[model samples]
Target: MTAKPTLAVVGATGAVGAVLLQILSQRADIWGEIRLIASPRSAGRKLAVRGAEVEVTALSEDAFAGVDVALFEVPDEVAAAWAPVAVARGAVVVDNSAAFRLDPDVPLVVPEVNAHTVRTRPRGIVANPHCTTLTMIVALGALHAEFGLRELVVSSYQAVSGAGRAGVAALRAQLSLVAGTELGTGPGDVRRAVGDDTGPFPEPVALNVVPWAGSLREDGWSSEEMTVRDETRKILGLPRLPVAVTCVRVPVVTTHSLTVHARFQGEVSVDGAREILATAPGVVLCDDPAAGEFPTPADVVGTDPTWVGRVRRALDDPAALELFVCGDNLRKGAALNTAQIAELIAAEPA
Candidate 1:
């Protein structure tokens, strides 16, 4: 048998990094050495992976030496700077950031949808799609494979954890302040309770929904919304696919839910879509209206697969189908996808 490859987990101390560690532990052990790399402050910390404690080394040029594959869960800037370093040091990088998702030389990968794109990476880096895109793409990909997707209109109900640890902390703090109080009914009531600590969000995310996620882009479009459009098209190999998106930040902790209005090339039936979703890899169909069975963030959190529900053909348009989908943003949205891509690279014959 070929020698097992060495693996490096960059940003091994962040929120997604923590979840990645758990996933690495639970999955099949395909690596020989699992090297943990974090920032300087986190260098000495020992994190558990594959049932063993591994000391985190601070991010540096030498850290990628002798590593076959490196999984990166750092910020865009950090990834933009360090991913290339890892690649230069002979490590194939699977980065979970927005840094290289749009790079023509790099492949934006979702294992269930675009696994074949992994081998064509000329930049030696595979980019993971946005969490919002990942939440719905698997189910959409399955339906598209059958009916041929033409257009997409999606609205995401994102969780606080999508913004990282500070977002989660902000929601908890705001909830604690407004828990026993008679707020949220009057004007500026929740704001008064939340004070100035909105964390990464522009407005109070407790007892509120902000119709914004990423920074402002052209024509009032948010970066998050544009990411959904661009990444979806890139992953599905549809360059001119019409995609309109509106991203909202909700009060949930981990899971992200989206209401997708997909229009196919031809008439689509609810039964057909349901069958595709139910049997598709990495998708779980839970659509039963009369019994009040639908995937919700609370129930979908900590799960791996995309939980899809509310499957119905549009009443007015035979070409359109409306569905609700949920996924743990930190799991399939980030770490698991990165890990899956790395595993794909590992599976290649040396």
Candidate 2:
């Protein structure tokens, strides 16, 4: 690796890709030449990065040449097919896709938690954790380092944007449809009101909450629920840690919120947890209920740090803690985390 690595941003036309570009522009200039690559349909378009307009190129073997680092934000199938190609052309891939996350050779990293693992990528790829998992892991990673996590019971209130641009468009369309009308939660009230406007969601996201995210699996858990459980364990390096997750689609536009009930080995205290999170990097402690202060999606959107609040020790169990966390699904949850890992690699290349 050279002093200034040549970087490539794959899927540069997508929502997360846009956030990645913004983050790149905000950070120091550690990159030399930045190449933008997207699908054939998005090719010939130009995007402004670091005060320069770079034309998007179609993904091909030539595009990967001379790229020292490739950051990807495409779908699973796309990453599965193209990551090796980028690696074959001698670029280290930091992928924000589910394709290589669970692969044994690919390391799933959150720089705050497992920055050291980025150096051990046998497949020349590092997978970013699920957005929902990234939302809570920064704080939990700090807590777990102190308290030793044993189990987790999480219920996620994910925004429509987690489903990508289509999900956001669907919610906006439904909100427009029900703007002047009375929409109820009764049988098919929302379904009829937003007919054929659910986008990628299973139900209307404007007037109601969908109890599912991702495809249903044979074990009755959605793919998202499984991703949260699996990715959390992997990022924390706790393979046997028991995790139970329930995913729901909320009406919010950008940020994702989670209610985490964590059980740790040994006794835990609220003051200890608060003290740890207060000083932890990439985390903001926002707990103060009497002042009507707690992290919310409306306030946390566009922020890079995970906001943690409503933290308390479980009354029935001294070793358990309950907390609420919120973060921008696109920024910190997806783009920022990947950027952090890539920076780590840039700082110390193999």
Candidate 3:
């Protein structure tokens, strides 16, 4: 029998990395060796995986030795610097960072939407899309497949965890401050109570919504908003597809939710779109307003599939449909997608 491939998980101690370890433990074990790697400070830490504990090694060129696949869950700068090193060491890199997502040579992949693009990676790197895009793309891809998507208008209700541990910490701290008090009744009251320590967010995220996520970009668009627009177009192979997005940071601890307005070619039917989303791989349709069943972050957190609901045809435009989608940003948005891509590569003949 052929020997199983060795896999390396970079940033093994991070938030997404933690979830990745859980996913690896839950999924079928196809790896002969799973190496845990993190920053120098996190080295020597042992993390659980596949019913065993693996010690994390510090990030370095030597860590990629004999590894067949390397999954990166580090910051964009870390990935930007080390991914090529992994490639040089003869490892296929599946990076979950914005560093290579838009590189014309590096394929931005969401397995359910564009699995075929994985084989065309000239840089030996596959990029996972931003959490906002991943939160909605699976359902959109399903509809686009049948109806031919033309344009998209999206507004995101992103979880605090999407900003990493710091964001989660900030929200919890602020929530504690405002939990039993009448703080939000007056203007600037929550801000005064939460103080200037908003962690990664611009304003207090608890008991409030900040209409910003990433750094400011050109034309008043945030980096994250543009990310959803650009990554969606790329993943769907629609280079010029019109996409408008507004990303807001919500107090939720996990899972990202988005309201999507997708305009497709020709007339569309609510029944037809519902059927498409209901049967789409990596998607779950939960539309039923009468039963109070629609995708929400609280219900969708900790799940793998993108949960979609509120499926309806636009009243004014027969060519458009509006829907809501939710997905665990840390899972399908990061770890799960990376794991799926690595599995796809692992299944290929060596």
Candidate 4:
């Protein structure tokens, strides 16, 4: 039997944070005492865990004093500021932010692929891949192992939830407006007017798709696009991995889906990728286009694994593989991944 480990969940009131708390409660065998920490605004809020409620406390420098593992589900700035502090105090930090994903010392881990990186805690801080990279790697990692992946051309149909809790609210608000007046904004939902409609993005996300996911980088690529490209290399340990990513925000509220076309170094049959995805950890295969059975965001919400379906061999190109994948952005995409990292680290003393 594995020894239970003391856990501290930072940002316990956020969207992904709440899911982390729930997943932890569901897996009691992997946890000991659990501490829920959030911002001062959310401090003292009560959240249920294992059928009982726990108080959410404001995270401080001393929050990690006696913790064995700390799962960070907050924004990058919060993780950047507190992750090192927690590590210094003694806890291993599993961060679900983009802050340290590209840090040379930090191992951006996807448990299904390079979980060994989590075991070797050289930096005391480990990164969970971006929600997009998280699902893409699960579907592709098996193929990368069976036949080395050389290039990836990915176009993501990401759910609003991928942007965090705010993204969810934005979608619902816009949907209500569109449903009422065919994309007419009401006076009441002011947030939908200013920021979402060409404010945060160049155009409104109501009943439409936004080509950008994150803020612009100096290189013209959005931050979300860069994350998908960089984090894939980190998890797959393939530096110089050719990846072209276009991230778009869809109207859905929970699951994020990706259409990936990968060119491999060696020959890979579609049947081979199918067989590998069937048994791969953290992946659920659903490729049956003829029978109308394929993974969909509607079916993937609340599920823990990345659902891969719509598998096909590329037309006019044998080495190129095309597939569709969807995973709950709030679950497997963010919170569950963080909790799983903490669970894995807890199994062995950090």
The Cα RMSD in angstroms, rounded to one decimal, for candidate 2 relative to the true structure is 1.0
**Model 3 stretches astray by more than 4 angstroms:** none
The residue-by-residue lDDT of candidate 3 on 1-350, one tens digit each, is: 12699999999998899999999999998889999999999989899999898999999999999989999999999999999999999999999999999999998888888999998989999898998899998889889999999999999999999998888888889999999898889999999999998899999999999999899888899999999989998999899999989999999999999999999999999998888887899999998999999988888889999999888889899999999899999999889999999998888775
- Give each model a TM-score: 0.99, 0.98, 0.98, 0.93
Per-residue lDDT of candidate 4, residues 1-350 (tens digit): 13767788898888888787778778755677788999999888999877789898888987777888888888899899999999999888999888988988888877778888876667899988899888678879988988899999999988877877777776776666557453344543434543545434455677677799888897789989988998888788889998999999877888899999999987779888888989888888888779999988898888888899888889978888899999898888888888777767767643
| lDDT of every predicted structure (CA atoms) | 0.94, 0.93, 0.93, 0.82
**Runs with alpha carbons beyond 4 Å of true place in candidate 1:** none
RMSD of each candidate relative to the true structure: 0.9, 1.0, 1.1, 3.1
Candidate 1 least-lDDT 10 residues? 1-10
Write down the TM-score for model 3: 0.98
For model 2, the stretches where C-alpha displacement exceeds 4 angstroms are: none
TM-score of 2: 0.98
**Candidate 2 residue lDDT tens string, 229-276:** 999989899999999999999999999999999999988999999999
lDDT of 3 at 144: 92
Worst 10-residue lDDT window, candidate 4: 182-191
